[model samples]
Target: MADIVEVRNKQVIFKDYINGYATGSDMVVTSDATIRLELPKNDDSLILTKNIYLSCDPYMRNRMNRTMEGNYIDSFTPGSPIVGYGVSRVLESSHPKFKKGDLIWGLVGWEEYSLIKDTRTFIKIQVTDVPLSCYTGILGMTGLTAYVGFHEICSPKKGETVFVSSASGAVGQIVGQLAKLFGCYVVGSAGSKAKVDLLKNKFGFDDAFNYKEEQDLNAALKRYFPNGIDMYFDNVGGKMLDEVLRNMRVHGRIAACGMISQYNLDKPQGNYNLLMLIMKRIRMEGFLVFDYYHSYPKFLEMILPLIHEGKITYVEDIVIGLENAPAALIGLFNGTNVGKQVVAITNE
Candidate 1:
């Protein structure tokens, strides 16, 4: 057994339940917390981890609300550290499946070190050739999200016309690439010109537009997909969704991955195009990635090769320290990060 080691642990704590959008002030980052780098005596189920990288996801915004409605996860406690997907190096472990020095990714606290009791959410890292940070986004939850949401939920067909909202984001970028690989004609929308360029030039989307510049989203969709959209991978909901519904082809499929547009609002804007679903015979479905985690091995098998062979590309907007996590997370809502936002607590 390794000697018990105690160290100062820096943590990003959730200050309180919030209303509307979140800001850096809603969280407190401090190094006052400390932890013993060992599992509690005789506890065979607990795992001690040194968090290496933490993921900043837009869905975390809803979890900060005082009252979580229809959310799969619970709201963060007022005085505790925020928890999210992260990659960590195991320092000590009592669980039969893990051991000291093993790397894993799943739900972890926003801290330098986390004592993980729940192993159900954790998955051991088998491949180390890629950047470990990839586990926080591409090789982890967001990658799986793009795969399942597009391939399974969207039920995409080759040569079909597809549109992805927030196409420059972690999930959206991958979704667009997957659609293209599946022999579909893809168009994407992002918030900035650089992101739009990235979609067309980097990810090989057929076309991309800056959504913020479009006065009428309906017109933009019409210009891109004159034949009407066959599949819609929706990340930004609200207005975009309503417009897309009007432009969808008959028998179209919509995968409702997220509603980032409505997260900060007190009352979510309603989509007024419910009638379009009926008129077009659309199949729109909302999915939580947790439900499809059972197929993670299959997802990795498909994604890893594409990544290595250069068929797929992933970009990350990584911040260097835990102290900067609040700003990194807050930036997700304001369109600040250009790609997957990750906070690197330490290099392993």
Candidate 2:
């Protein structure tokens, strides 16, 4: 190899601990950041890669906080580069499973280049016909979330009445479609009219509505699920969860995934309709994708065929360049994206 050299790396740096919603102010992109062209030392399992696409997930907002007690992942260090799930191409590797030019998906930094220290989370990209950026959402963690939450946790049945909140999102879109494939009558609620269209048209939901237009959430649920819902895949919590509880059929099951509604809330509101759970004998469970990562290969086996046959479709709202990362992340909460919001740092 040539003599080691430092290269200027364009990076999005986390500036401080955030409270409430994460704003663009919390992060700053600097074009002058530098990284060595070679690995530092003796890290045989580590892989050096160039990031291609980065995911902007709601769960990542929790990682921007300073607390460690209630959060699932450790807080991002202030003044350091923030990291999340991403797709990258390995440029140099000491790991036996990877080599130069191998594309992989895993946890990576919000920089042009990253020295990925852990190999445990890494998954070599085995398929490429689909958009490479898709690995950041569907075909990656988001797809796994829907598979485990709906099929495993919720245990959907044929002819069951299902509902999905935040239905136009990465996981929500897939979850709704899976419910339909399972022979369930599915309804989904989104924040905007465009998302409502995407849910009903692209993802093939039985019914979809813009939640913002509903003055009474309970009434909206009643209109869609007149017979009451059998299964609910919850992405946004807070009022949506409470309203869903009020409309669930007896023996209903709820798979609680991410609570994007309460992600930025410092003092989260309690659900008043929770008593309906006891009355209806409903089962509500919260799940993390990490718990079902072992089944990822199986998930790929199941979805790849559906994708190939055009039985399933995924929508992505991708923004180009690492400099625009902050706006793309903040836009998730603002209803600015049609489907999954992904930042394309590079295509290589």
Candidate 3:
């Protein structure tokens, strides 16, 4: 008989349809007993997996509301396991592309082990030089988002003045660093004093500020970029975005990576300074990371070298154990996470 530890699969369940701000209690973790890993007797199309790490993203908020329509991302079903990108180790594989011991990163259930049938979507991890948890953040979707949003969307130029909101966040951190490497004068806005300090002292942002402390966002932008912002990476939308629009230079570019500010609101807020885009000849565009999936190889080529040479740095805020996954994810909305939020399961 195979020795099997009682797998208490803890899943974050959606309480109900959300209207206003989301609370940690909105999600409940239900523990269930799971059987030991077992290979399919006849099916050669399924792969049993043990999730090692789970990614906590801001976008998951969209899935909470059932009434919201036209959202390209799928909503999490009530009374079922919440799904997101995860780094997992294959325990039993029947797919040709994956083997029994392969480490992969892709969409997986919140529980301990998942029987995934769609192996095509999963990317097999060939590189082990970096930490496995990074697959959930910098080395994965977050990195890809920063790369495509910066290089492809913003189309930054040297000596340009760049401003990034949520600058210490998963995507924002990389975006600011990339802008710096491109020889742009970069400034960042973070939620906390600690995050602002990390942006200036650690992440090498030329200047950074705590958005919470700024009474007038327009004045804050003027203080950072006196000449005018040539590129704006809009991570937190609403007031910050409106201020950036007001201060953008002619032909400026804005890459709308995320709108963290509006995620918790029942009704989306409108920017008062919409006319500024016309006056400044600014180009604002929203992008999804999956849109640039074909260019991922090109992105990896550009970023991997920077990582190896120590030209780029990544910071992750890891919460231990699958049991804490719900709290880790809920913390993102409150700006509790300092960097890329990830749940480290098993610590291996």
Candidate 4:
């Protein structure tokens, strides 16, 4: 017999396939029966782990919709626990690659305890100097997304004029800082005054503006980049991207990371100025972070030193308890989370 604890596990479940903008009500928190530390009889193919922290990302919004066509990633099944990238500790392992007491980060069920069969998805943490929660943000997918998308896709040059949208979010902040380190004149656009201030003061952006306050995003971009933008790290699609396309300089590069602005729409807003891409001979490409996993080791080698030297700073908005997971997940669509949103399930 295995020892069992009465785990008060609170989990967020997808009510149904979502349509249009995601809402807090789209997900509900429910409790499950207590779980044991050991696997069941004849079950030697699973890894039991306790989730430590859960990440809330904009990409998750796409997983909520049923009709969305690009089956590149499977949609979360309804009535089941929603899943996302998280940091966890192995409690029991049946797999050879993972052992008990290993701290890892990867795709995890939204519940407190997850019995994962595909153990290969998990990445064991080799560095413990940084906060463990960083695996959900800067040191994890978000950081790699910014690094690969900027360096690999955009191919930035020193002294070039760069513009970033949603510039104060997890990936955006890092992208702006990296551009600055490469000696680019970087400007960013955020949703609020506080985030704009953070872009300028904390992230070392040349200039930043509250896009919500700007009557015209095109004029704002033009005002900030008088000579025109050489590189655009686009996060918010729709109007912002449309304006950016119009303002791009010849041979400019655009790395389309995410389109948070259009994620919730029934029909994604289409760009009206795409002709500018052809006229300016611009290069635009979209990417998923997982595609760049091969380069993760090199990315860590470059970013870890910057983090230790304080050249890069990461911000997290942590919500405690699994009970708060639904609210925290929903906050991403509403732009309510100030930094990288995460749910801290346990102190350890």
Candidate 5:
């Protein structure tokens, strides 16, 4: 057996409830938390894990505020380590489903080490040749989110025009490519010119525009979708949504994945054209990835081959260390990352 080792566990601690936009100051990186290497034998379900990668996602911004709606996810407690989806390797385990050296991806603390008492939400790494870092993005929750939102919520049809906002993002990138693979006409709107170019050239988006450059969003949509948008994969809400609603065709289906634009707002943005929902008879539905985890195997069954066969590609902007996690996380709101933002906690 490996000898027990005691070590300092570095953590990113939540400072307080947020008001407007969150900055790196909202989370503090500290090395004060410490843990023993030995796994506790009292509980059969306990798993001791060494975190390898941490995910920095837009939805995490929702948890920074104390006033969020109940039952979705809890607000991060002040002075406690911020928690999110992470890829980890089992250091030790008393759980039947896991053993030492087993790699899994699920919700875990933003720390070097963790004592995970619950294993139900975790999915073991079944395929290793694919980059393990992908577990934090394409191969993990982010991929599942893209899969469920596009295929499950939107129910896309071939030759249909599909519009995706935040189209260069982790989920949005996959959604656009999946739409193309389904024989849909895909157009995407991203925050920057580089991302817009990525959407058009790399992800195979039929057309893409930098939303920041467009003086009139509705006009841009009309220019891109002259016939009208048949399906809209909305990653940004607020004004973008309002404009898309005006340009949607009758019976268009909208999958509400994330509203990154509204995450940091003190007051959420309201839509003036929501009456278009009734006028066009569009179906706008919101979904949570947790509700669709049962389809993860199904997601892999489809995505893995595409990845290996080079039919699908993914990008990740990785920060090297846990200490830089706060800045990396805050960068999501600022559009600093061109693709999926992942923090490498360990070189392994």
Candidate 6:
């Protein structure tokens, strides 16, 4: 029998259920935990994995809340390591589908090593031409969310005017690019001039603006979409959604992908312009990415070629070490990350 190997696992523990915005101090990183780098006896379904790269996304803020009453996903336990999407290499596995040395991406704990029992959601990495880190953002959940939201939900048409909020971020960036590629007139809004430039110049958005500099968001939308918006890919909900409701054209479609602006608030902001939906015959729909996992293979087929052909662009803001994961995650709320925020645990 092979001698068992034991390794120390560093984990980012959630200090407590947060009441307001989360800070770096809210999570405590400890190196005291140790685990055997092999599957346990009698556990045929367990997979022991060494997490390689972790994704820090805006949706994670909701899981930090004490109660996830109406949320689709469960809240993170206060004393345990937080969990999110990540790429991992299997160290040991008793499962029939996965073996030692297999690379996969799915939900993983915020730790150096994780003992995963459920492999249903995990996906094997088949494409090697792109960086493995892209599995965390562009080629993973973020990419699928953009594809499903725009292609499936919005039902975009050629020559349509599409506007994406938070357009320099992970999902938004892809949405804007797809819209531009689909022959739609695409415009985007970001928080900073740098992000604005990235959306316009890097992502090929027809136009882009800094939302922070705009005193009146309604006027900003009008300046970009003088006629009216045919479709709106909303990322920041709150006031932006309210302003967008008034600018939507008749029979316009709105894909509510995320509401990052209202995630940390004690009481979420309400949209008062909802009446416009009825008046303008607009269809505003909210969707969860979990509902569309079945279409991932279809998404992969479309995106992989675009990536290889240099028809699309993906940017990642990666921080070295798992210890810096907390800061990288918190940076999302303030627009500190220019693109997809990723944490690299180890290259091995």
Taking all chains together, the TM-score of candidate 6 against the true structure is: 0.98
> Where's the lowest-lDDT run of ten residues in candidate 3?
1-10
* Candidate 5 clashing pairs, residues 3+ apart or interchain: none
lDDT of 3 at 285: 92
Off by over 4 Å in 2: 1-5
Summarize candidate 3's per-residue lDDT along 1-348 as a digit string, tens digits. 456454666666777777778777777777764645776578888898999999999998888888577797877888777789999999988888889999999999887888897776688887889889888988899999998898889998899999999999999999999999999999999989999999999999999999899899889999988899999998889888988998999999999989989999977898899888888888999999977778877877888889999999999999987768778887888889999999887766
RMSD score of candidate 2 (Å): 1.2
After superposing candidate 4 on the true structure, give the runs of residues whose Cα lies further than 4 Å from its correct spot. Answer: 2-8, 41-45
* lDDT of residue 154 for candidate 3: 95
In model 6, state the lDDT of residue 38. 72
How far does residue 13 in candidate 6 sit from its true spot (Å)? Answer: 0.8
Q: Encode model 2's per-residue lDDT on 1-348: one tens digit a residue.
A: 567778888999999998888799899999878888677677788788989999999888888888946667889989988899999999889889999899999999899999888888899998999999989988999999999999999988899999999999989999999999999999999999889998988899999999999999999999999999999999999999999999999999999997888878887887899899999999999999988889999999999999999999999999999888999998988778889999999644
| Model 5 Cα lDDT, one tens digit per residue, 52-142 | 9999999999889886776398889999999999999999899999999999999999999999987888989999999899999999999
TM accuracy, model 2 = 0.98
State the lDDT of candidate 4 residue by residue for 1-348, as single tens digits: 445554665677788997887887888878764666676667666788999999999889888878567745888999888989999999988777888999999999888888888876689999999999999999999999999989999999999999999888889989999999999999999888888888888889999999999898889888998889999999999999999998999999999999899988888778899889889999999999989899999999999999999999887999998778888887877777777899998656
Error at 55, model 1, angstroms: 0.5
User: TM-score of each candidate?
Assistant: 0.98, 0.98, 0.96, 0.97, 0.98, 0.98
- Note the residue pairs that clash in candidate 4: none
Against the unseen true structure, what C-alpha lDDT does each candidate score? 0.94, 0.92, 0.87, 0.88, 0.93, 0.94
Q: Is candidate 2 or candidate 3 better by TM-score?
A: 2
Candidate 5: where are CA atoms >4 Å away?
none
Give the Cα error of residue 345 in candidate 1, in Å. Answer: 0.7
For residues 222-322, write the lDDT of model 1, one tens digit per residue.
99999999999999999999999999999999999999999999998998998999999999999989999998999999999999999998989999888
Candidate number with greatest lDDT? 1
